[model samples]
Target: MSPSAVKRKLSSSARSVSPPPLRRRTDAVQAQRAAQTESTNHSHKLNFYSWNVNGIGPLLQKQISFTPDATYPLRNFLKAHEWPHFLCLQEVKINRADTATQRRVELAANAGAQSDEPTYSTHFSLPRDKYNATGFSGKVHGTATLTRDDTLETAASVPDFDLEGRVLIHEFATIPLVVINGYWVNGTSNPYRNPDTGETQGTRHDHKLRFHKHMLDLCKSIEERRKSVLLLGDMNVAPTRIDGHPNLRTSPIQHVINRADFNLKFLDKDSETGLKGIDVFRHLHGEKKKYTYHGRGRPWGESCDRVDLIVASRKLVDDEAVVMDTDICDNPHDRGHSDHVPLWVSLDASTWLNQSESKVD
Candidate 1:
């Protein structure tokens, strides 16, 4: 073959095997990575429910010592609403010493079953007898949380605050979240009566100062670890004037203190020195009036305040897959039980479970 013909054939081979332009190669790689992320990511709707049951006894049994009824108010709740992934109960009024009572509460919570294995894992933060000094039993202020058995990586209560059975912290197995369930101290201004002296002592409002400061720290601790937080249960604070009916609080100063603390430190979106906790309700429905707690016998709308809340971390809210819906249940129940009605939030399963699920119970 001639030298010119050989050279031409070599040039053709080189042109055929040439690499793609840099931009094209980069875009191809980016498209492949995007596809992988899209495949792994998903949208989910997970329901979580919370209620201040007042007492666990009435739902399962007429009294703590009696047998649980065949049908219960708790049963009515579960059947009526989407079976929640986590059910947070506040003011359970149970003590650690009463293991039997705790077990009964657990049994009723897990579909009121006495024989079947429990589908939920129950965790309670029981109270100490510190208040016994004031002629009141500390056993009346417990907080509890129940989730599916496999959902937790770790679980605990606040060491100092839980003496009144006020808090439970849960780290989940499937999400980068640390959940806190609390029955926050009620800052009632009525001074405790000393039966011995027939006189009054300082108010329970003192506990409020400490309880809230620690609550802020707890959220910060989770934020420091780069994990999100979802805190729910009866916080006992109305948060703003619109959150309460006028004059519902007997202690305005105490109420003001608490409302300020919760608003400025956590729920304020413009906060520069906070965990930037998102009030799930306010985030979804801005300034729309809603109430969760009602006066015992009055009509709900006539006299009530919205004290129950589900607050989330900014990180969690920023995630596109996690849809937090504001269909909070504040109503006359299918079966009326507690003065404080049930409330809940919806989360997408794809945000954690990486799959889609049925929206219904």
Candidate 2:
């Protein structure tokens, strides 16, 4: 079936099921403030979705089944969530030399061709180093951003950080907003070594720290310009103990341990600038044990963590620009889609965009 037909079928199926209720807050004052804000700004909202698709090439291949009931997770996801104006994807793993990879990119770029859905202007950042002599094919992994046509005025990648195609930045034409789609370096395999001692300097832990520092500096520069920024991706870090699996050891060898440390540094308020970030999902759904990634291909036990996240500038968080319902799409039935599920956020564009304009004036 065509994309449109698949969407129509899914729409019918979705109507039979009701969504789960949101958790209630104990603080009455906070609830009252949120109610007031919701009443005032109910008209303008923009949905954003971020997924580390694991690999676009593989997803496209798996989605080509002939049976009607065969699970085409990626295609079904796109059809079901038509509200997202911006879709950010990571670990696309599309190399320039692969023709199949080129075809998959083209299909994604022209996703709305046969339907009434809004077309997206796709931008990709492939690895700068084409040849992979290091045995680790870091050059094949990449990130992508697909924004509604005419929505973006400027788009580019960070200089040093773009080496492995890990980051893509998009600036909107009318709004003072910058959306950064990133696939942070997974330092698990690349151990940091000291030149003088000829021993392990910091292991994968040190490599991740350096990566976070670069990301922090880049985000700081954008916020310095007074733009309301939304940075979303597989950060590869779970902020606290609450975000990590309880059974996992909090050791240097453990990825969660090192990643959590860097997460704190990234979210820390700068002494001079006083800028900070708010993890939107955790802010809304406090202490909810939602896991976005399942480690070692285990279903969901002690190996899961909420590594995928959407972090926004404090200005946007303080202004109540986020429309509360953030989620981790962890569907066990759709295992073939990816190991890491998608995370999404809804933002009140009218409120934030106006506030940003006033800052300029």
Candidate 3:
């Protein structure tokens, strides 16, 4: 079946499942007591934040060159807010030589005077193997995840999908939840056609489709094992028209090259397990027109899109332990740092990580 047909089917099926009711916040006095008891209880909620840094080297340079009084956007933002327990970054773009230095700087900036060594452990994935064999320098381009809870350990990555440093999987100690961080392939255009065969040349769009298909298969495999999953990153595809400007449906840009491919890859349910993906942001703020990425050289409202996403299993959404609060960070300070804004969500770690009986959809 065509991708659009699959999308329609998924949409219709989704409507059949009623959404979970919202929970009420604790009263002020109750909140105070909860805060007092938070330290003793291991059931506190956790925060998860994800961002596409574009290129880490340039961002670091920008932060370092700032005048004493001038604010380092990311650093200041990290210091100003209460840090999340888990932080995932995409398009980090750093090589081996720069990893240590970059990590130290980031840790120090985020740590502030709180500690010399922050509690969070960091991991990075760089392009390797065939990628380097193609004369591609394994340099500044990758993904990284930092977690305050040491229980989350690195797991095996999807074989071919990790070529461009695009995927990272982490398994939690007690929870059946697996966090998948991805910087999906941005389908770029290649106008060159084969002269002899008169067939269109394969572009990055092909790779994007393949990557997404493999990712779906991987998620299905995880679900078969009865594990709950949370997939977050710069997916490079707006799952619905509500996700970006309506004009993007026809845009000639590389990222939006084959909209059908994206719809087919992400919108369809897993054929084997019947597992479907849910957009955490849209689920919370339906039809809200917010953009996380602004076009280069274009004014704010003139050209922008929401390519970053956080998708979770249906069971995770229903359990109320996976995604709590989600938003696109478009503060003035964060805007100047990168063209893409940060997307974050709050996770009820205690319930999600400890509740093994939680169903996996």
Candidate 4:
């Protein structure tokens, strides 16, 4: 079957439960294979860069830059370390009703490569007025993913929980990995009232919790298919207190609930039914006090939290030296300032991808 046909069948058949994925192979065997491959092979590495642009339209229009030194900030960022194979974004703030701009973005991204499958594939999940509790007024939540790799087979959103443009999942044929890029809802209960009717219906903490649940469910479903998952984006909830700085929650009921849920669902490696996504930054940094988001009009160091994350499945990272480096980066140029900085990871794709398909000629 064609790749598209296979994607369609998978989506339609997602309702039926599949048998659990088989247990991983022994680590001794994995290490033997890793010893044969160079950990520093640039050709066998895939670099994934993720940032919640806060508003992507400005970046596209050149109205803003991640830094001051470059006219095209994206170009500067791409070459900052290595070429970013996949650029995953969050908080795109694009409304669902706007189709014109979406089409334009696709056109611009694939301008030169005009094939049925362009050199770049872009997918955006935007918020719709009918689907949002606050009625999708002003810039809200959204997510997008762009990839130039031809192995990208499908791009999709979470089934029932995708109305707010919070999640985007990409499946690639050449790799044994699924990428789940999400911009999770900030935990808030602010209500938006109708100007005249005084009828109020805004978001509550429940909405945020439900979004987390749906993303986890999607991860579980994908893992059942025997593909490792890389879940990355602005998850919003800090799993531990150390993640927050000057963290003035002082133990609010909301914090307690949110933290506990995150711990069990994503952080807990022992949970038989949880997503079990290993926190890549924490795993590498080891309680290092670094922050990704600066809030409340505070400078980065004074008040911030590492809300942005890059979590990978255990199966994908178990091999030694798969994760080359993971770090939280700040703006090198002083021109434009965004609250959230970029988080990136470079990994040896050959370590996890099937050896036969790992190398691309």
Question: What's each prediction's TM-score?
Answer: 0.74, 0.73, 0.72, 0.74
How high a TM-score does candidate 4 get? 0.74
Candidate 2, number of clashes: 0
Residues 1-361 of candidate 1 have per-residue lDDT tens digits of 2111111101222112112211222565445544443343222355678888887777666223355545455554554674565788887777567677766655555544333222344667776535432123445877776664322234444555456677877765445777788888787776643334646566667656566778888889888887788889889888777888854564666677767777787788788876678888887899998888876777657888889988898777776437458656667762156778778887754534432122211
Cα lDDT computed for each candidate against the true fold: 0.64, 0.62, 0.60, 0.63
Candidate 1 stretches greater than 4 Å from native: 1-44, 62-71, 111-118, 132-137, 150-160, 190-203, 246-251, 319-321, 353-361
Model 2 C-alpha lDDT per residue in residues 1-361, reported as the tens digit of each score: 2111111111212111112212332476434543443343234567789988777755554455566434334444655776366788898876644444544553544433333333344567666543321224543567776554322234444456556677877765456678888888766656555433446666655666776778778878887887777889988877777777765445556675565556565565554532378888878988888877875456466578788889888877786555556787776643346788788998766655455556656
Q: Is candidate 2 or candidate 3 better by lDDT?
A: 2
As for TM-score, the candidate ahead, 1 or 3, is 1
How far residue 263's Cα lies from its native spot in candidate 3, in Å, is 3.3
Off by over 4 Å in 4: 1-42, 62-71, 103-119, 129-138, 149-158, 191-203, 248-251, 319-321, 331-336, 352-354, 357-361
State in Å the error of residue 358, model 2. Answer: 9.4
Q: Which consecutive 10 residues in model 4 have the weakest lDDT in total?
A: 1-10
